[model samples]
Target: MMGTSGGSEEIIILSDDEDDKDTSCLIVEVEAVKKTVGVLPVSPQDEDLVVTFSRRPDVLPHARYDCPIHPFMPTDCERTAPMANNELICDQCFCYICDKLASLCGMWCCSGACHCNSHNKSDFWNDVRNTALLGELQRFNLTLSEVDHHLRNADTMLQSFRDELSALFSSIPLDQAMLPDYNINQQDLSSRYGPVLECVTLFLNKADKKNSRAAAIMHLGAAEEFMRHFQVLGFMGSSSAATTSETIIMLLHRVISSVQRRIVMGDITPLFMQKLQTFYQNRICFPADMRPLKNRFKCFIFGRNLSPVFCSLTIRPWQDVLLVSVLKGQNVSGFRKDKGKKDILFETISVVLLRTELLQLQSRYRELCRYLRVVLTDNTTLYQHLQDLIPFFKCKLGEFGSALESLFPPASPPASRFTPPIFLLYLRIFETATAPRLTVSQPEQLCFSGASWEPIKDAVPLKRSELVKFALKAQRCSLPVGSDPQCWASLLKVVCSPHGSPTALPVPSQQFLHESRDAVIDLLNQQGYNIQISRCFLKTYPDQALLLLVTGALGVRILQGSFSPALPVLHAYKDNLWAFQWLCEGMTSSEDRLKSFLKEITQESSNT
Candidate 1:
């Protein structure tokens, strides 16, 4: 201890006497000068490092003993940056540690360990980072080139069973292939792969930006292949990469984001074709009959937040194929659903938004009652926004429920179930590479994150004004929009058509939607009523019929504690249980297609 002795201290005086010499000799360490001590002696086989000092009793006494160091002789005063501020506990990315790359936050990723004694900046270590970063860049480029090439030249990339999934995930070597598994411990890794993981972490961390958007697209293709290979070969033997939840999340995000970006670009890449091939094969994402895998929540959260771009893409034909993935209770994605196996579906998105939007908004407030009162006080935008989403909300509900049935059919496994499967055939045709060959009847419906009618009346001939007036009047006066001469003709058609119960308008096929819409408008104008999907059933049928019919088909038994039932289920919420109301409505299909569709919907609702 650096302490001062209080009171009187005795001072020793040197004497020339022989007795004095003996005392002086006792004060000196005989072994200290004779022995050579090492800084740190480490054996290749053992991580344990031994730092030894000469066995000298005299020097040991004068060592001050605060810390057991040798006698003062310029003892090293080891220190690191003052323990980072209690409030400033930010951790640096491995890239910052290795390659000196900055985080999305424009600063070099740093941590207490950045300059730790255990691992510090040495020329050798510095060279290791620089060299590894170079290889990482090269690997990045190589995988990028492979994905881009495959996306362009289906001829070469999609040739065999092996050359698929180059879009969603990539196959970069650990160049210093230290940790073959993602779960390798930091100390266990080649001290090089840390930066690589950091680079990946940065990519996965970003939320809603363009740069991160494109990379995920390319990675998904490769991930698709990697996962498939994992399923077939069981090559890695339950290592973290093979079974971690985080890896799976990253894998799905990459594929989903890639498809979205490529589709938006209107460029059909080879990976797209490969995906089509895979779809037709009814191949499992992970091989069936493999050992069960556990879920990794952290990685899934990262992927979920990073996946806005992927989430926005309206999966027309693909949802039918992808939803078949019975979300293992262990492997659910971003959606915060408890029933993971059945919960994550496109329809489940509404549930997420409902929970998240409120939670996020609430986080910004101190008191719930004050905020609730504020919301109550303002009917302005809040009420209007809610009103606008009504039509869109209904569609989401239907789509979500429908997704559950389509995706998770009971008593059927993925691979063996699709024999002469028409559903598989449809997906393949949609995914086919050569050219756009779509049947008129097999029209692909385009779902929307937003709604039509109110939002999209600009496309209609009669101004948005006239349409709204009719809808409002229908609502207030209890008159079908079709009952008025201006609105009556259209109302009758929707009322007369067997399937015309309109709790939700159908997601119109892109090719046939405009024509159906035009048919609806014309029918309204000519016949004083209309048929087909519409904004409100008031123009066609009474409120009772529409509400009862739609709710019945939904088949969701409402749970007691729900925030909002009028919601859209993005892919994650497909299996959310709604407290459904059922009726004993007899839906017998007579002769008409409309009648048959309605009847089928009704019958299915009751039977289920």
Candidate 2:
């Protein structure tokens, strides 16, 4: 029995196997194996590695050598062996060094060596254990280093993918002139974007394999955002082409989504078309097998914001198909939940207004108001004048007018009237593409920064009202003098257009009026614009004449200059007529162009 050097346990070998019994013998076999395999040299620390084992003190004396009597010597030559007294018995003729089993053999000890050439037993035994442990540790470190390398590579790939995605978005062709010549081939787009998406998918797979929860979630979100850009591009394409059916468009979207799922879930071995075909067929039918896949796709696309998804899923497919079939000349159904034509018309107008009118007002008004506020607050004289034109209180008494009237009585002195110079400044700044910087006569001599209000003011206007009246009565079609601008400018155009029915506009009454007001308010809120001030103004002045006047003045300044003392304002009126005519010119042309495409589609479907 031998004890391990570390004192963990006693190794008792009762086997008849000679090679296994001796630790030195095992070490010799290991060295031979190393020579056969040709492994690299281990760490420098392993150079001194030694295997060690302890022997029982009681068995030390009984140690004996297994050597045959030399043929050259007489049979009388004695051998070392264990004695009946359990002790080593060596004859006088035998080598003294050979008598000690644990000692190094000398020249006289069995002709300088025993059966084993290794003379130092301690070094042999220690090396055996040390080499085994070192081999295992080397393997563990190798694996760890490989994983680290993989993660680093993935990070680099992710960054490259992000850069490519940015380039794709920034290069989108928005101009109509560029669209026909745009050279981003569909096939090339697919080829370029595929690898970028796959890199992200691969990173996600690796993260999942490593059980990195945070990394997996982050990559998943990034990939989703990446796909969102494509989705928006798809919408813009549909609007531009107007050839693809909604079904085909939706399926294409699903195809991309399906690719993401397959890649991330480790199932993307098939060809691209094969996967797309499978998803397309499966989605159109909604097979039981594909239900889970569809649900997962929805979950990823919408995350927890599932209102639209839930609504879409719950609605019957036949109903959607039926509505599409019927909408040759009619408005699209299944878009909004409203059942009445009047309500749907109002809702559609609300959506258009939010996107166009309210957005323009909120952005332009906020900027103009901020600068005006700073200017007015700094100079009381300017403030007093501006307040007179705008009225700090009220001009008339109505439902909510009495309170406003009390705040600013008509009988009071005219301290609030705006001077023509400052009023013209206010008008000209908004009218031009670039608002000029002002040096206000205040204590600080503040120089306000210029803002570009072109996006709002420079947009094409809808002039169907003038167009219709011009066709009906040529000489009488001029814009009325001293008239407030239309508040429902967009809707008025839609209703007055040749294609639109005059009856679509709701009759003016308490109910219809209240509904229109609510619709406007709701649209403003939905667009993330604060309508509290607008709402109060609308309620206080139900005619919307004041609101119209303010916007009309801005519009008129864009065409005809107001009376500011600045040179820019003085020169603006000469250019205003041309500018207004140009802005209004596109309205009819754009409507006609859009209608051409829409009518083609509707007519073809209706005929079918």
Candidate 3:
């Protein structure tokens, strides 16, 4: 008996002398085969490669070495005995039974069986092939179904969002004028139409979670579709046009409210907020004409506390035009040609007021401070007036102290001084006792910055009878008794000779002479002046028709010697009628004092 020890196992071979010799030779051959097929020790760096199993081991089917099975097989073939280890296979061998590379087939060089040349009809090999093929088909089917399910879900969500959007649009009026009140309740809207907002939010959140480009594209498409629908409804018109659609405005309110809520709750990231802001600026608020209105709306929504940041994002610099117009109760048509923009302005103000009423005391204080800052920066003339007006709100001074400090901190640089029309308009709206004194030489710098010929351009031709009436009204109202009979006579001859009886005067000549006397009278009445004052200013300043039309007076003392005082006021205000009108409407001083002030300012400007 001979024994051999391999690791922990001991093999004992009992044989006759001749048999023992053959067994020893067989053991030597087995040891040589094991040495030839042994696996190399894996290095630490190659540990990952150890787990990488090849599923497609038959990828290279061509022979790697010369063999009898190939085209160069010799007629007389020498065949070597199969090895006793499954891992040992000739490079050129292939398993016919497994339909794979012989090197990858474990049974190809098995100790008791070699399947490299096994017949295709073998039952054992057929079962192995069939099991693998069935498993692959099953996996492919599951993968395809998963893709289909995801596609269907996406379609369903998109359709649901579309339907919800349609419902929300249907609830709001297309025209703002149709609404009973301009104010919209954000909470009420969220309660009633929250699903629409939630649906959009859900899509955005899912896209973010999945990091999916397709999902992101889908969200963008939906947003575009919503905007397209708005345009189709005439709510988002061209740059030169305007829309009063309550639907779009309310939609904006809801969207902004939702986004703000999400941001506050930590449901969205700053990156997402930035993207949304960009989308709003580029897509919703890009039009040059609509910029003023939309910026005002955004400014109101963000409130005064965030004004600094919001102001930077605004498409244009902030202006108080809308607020001034609204406070003055001026007709929307007087401010802008677009009716839609007018409605939006009113609506935005209405919403701001409504929200103010509902806010907590601190919030209201912040809002007050914001308004104070706006007045201080844009309409410095009204800042003190607002301080006076603040008392009427019944807010305690102590409560606003903190907010005021934050807005105008100690030793902070003073706000840039400006004299916007709002300054004068606010004074008029509040009916202040006197205009604020200006430290700057020309507080009305913006007023005289450019020339305007609108008075001449807008004049209408009038009949001879109308001219006679205008002349009579002017003579009765403004002419001093027995002072200028020759002046009246000359004016009448000049007025009557231009056009015969019942003849129409040329528009340009009549503009200089009359300039729509009736309309001027109406405008004067609108500005709280009586018919006598209107007719007197019109008749006395027939040569300064542009001045009369703009300032509602000759902008000078009536019956004052020399037109020098009037000349300065006219020169400073002729082109900027809008600002001049605001100043005139707001002034509580007598005509002479206003004229003196204009002369002083003009002198200061010249000296500077």
Quick one: best lDDT, which candidate? 3
- Candidate 3, residue 90: the lDDT equals 56
Residue 322 accuracy (lDDT) in model 2:
31
- For model 2, the stretches where C-alpha displacement exceeds 4 angstroms are 1-293, 296-320, 330-567, 575-608
Estimate candidate 2's alpha-carbon lDDT, on a 0 to 1 scale.
0.32
Candidate 1 lowest-lDDT run of ten: 434-443
Per-prediction TM-score to the true structure, in the order listed: 0.21, 0.16, 0.21
Q: Over the full model, what C-alpha lDDT does candidate 3 score relative to the true structure?
A: 0.38
The deviation in Å at residue 186 for candidate 1 is 3.2
Superior candidate under lDDT, 1 versus 2? 2
Which scores higher on TM-score, 1 or 2?
Answer: 1
Go through the candidates in order and give each one's C-alpha lDDT: 0.30, 0.32, 0.38
Deviation of model 2 at 183, angstroms: 48
The sequence of per-residue lDDT tens digits that candidate 2 reaches over residues 1-608 is 44557535445555556677565433211122243666887998898888798773332242223222211221122224222322222332232234334333343324323312221244542343233223322211222222344334444545555676667565654342123424445554445444545554555555444323223222433444454554555432333232222222243343333333333333222332242334333323332322454433232221223211210111121123333332232333323444553222211111121222222234333222222222212224534433332211111101122212222343432322223232223223222213332222221221233522332233222233222221112111112211212212322233221233332222234453344444443433332111123345346433332222222333332333222222222123232233223323323435554344345535555665
Which structure is stronger by lDDT: 1 or 3?
3
Question: For each candidate, C-alpha RMSD in Å?
Answer: 28.2, 33.8, 29.9
Question: Each candidate: how many clashes?
Answer: 64, 12, 0
- Give residue 68's error in model 2 in angstroms: 90
